[model samples]
Target: GYIVTHVDRATKYLMAQKIESKTAEAFNKATLSMFMPLAPSKRLTLTLDNGKEFSLFNKIENRLKIDIYFADPYCSWQRGTNENTNGLIRRYFPKKTDFSTITDNELQKVVHKINSRPRKSLDYQTPKEAFSLENMSGALGT
Candidate 1:
């Protein structure tokens, strides 16, 4: 069992979901479900961790109609946003916490809190705000 996390590089918006297994089919299903609600334009590119669970990257690309790139192995900086997101998740559920015991409702609550919280990097605009197309132009990171 594993918890999958995805963070938007530009806005640092985070999406998290739990799967009962680490199998490729399970991984793909969880990942795709998360992106399904987002418009194709908002999810044009996905840079994923170099995990074997992502062996279905080709299928994901075809289904989402998006380019999929794998981050280089051993380089955390390449997926820094996701790494930071992992830490944020850990704050609520410590390292030894079991994903199986967590409920989808509980996970969604944490995701909501994180997205609604402001970040200095985004000029105090929450990721939810920065993620909206109308607020995409302004940036404190640059």
Candidate 2:
């Protein structure tokens, strides 16, 4: 299985799901499933790595109506927040872990831990608190 991650840039809120494949179709379905609960206004821009799984960016943009951008090749710094969160995820899942072995509930538990943990950047506020719809709108100046 492939673990797909979508993070809120402002609050560090993370929405991660486990998918069976890393194909463009899987990424599209995972992304839509992860973001569709929020209003279209809340689902704004998405910055993704230049991975083949994201090759279907046009379809994603059309479905989500969100602007999409890609980081320059070899420039992980452009997506610092996502990279840092991936480090945190590694604490649980690790680099060599077989993602297929983990159940959905186990993945959700990890996500809950991440969201509940306080971040130094947010003045120690948990992402869950900072990610409130109202708070996110204000933080995003929406």
On lDDT, the candidate that comes out on top is 2
lDDT of 1: 0.83
Task: Look at candidate 2 and give me any clashing residue pairs.
Answer: none
* Regions of candidate 2 where Cα sits further than 4 Å from its true position: 133-136, 139-142
Estimate every model's Cα lDDT from 0 to 1: 0.83, 0.87
1-142 in candidate 2: lDDT tens per residue?
9899988888899999999999999999998998778777777789999999999999988988888999999999999888988899999998999999999999999999999999998889998898895444553311
Positional deviation of residue 98's Cα in model 1 after best superposition, in angstroms: 0.7
Best by TM-score: 2
Counting clashing residue pairs in each candidate, in order, gives 0, 0
Residue-level lDDT of model 1, residues 39-130, one tens digit each, is: 66667778877778889889989998888888888998988888888899889999989889999999999999999999999999998888
Return the TM-score for each candidate structure. 0.90, 0.94
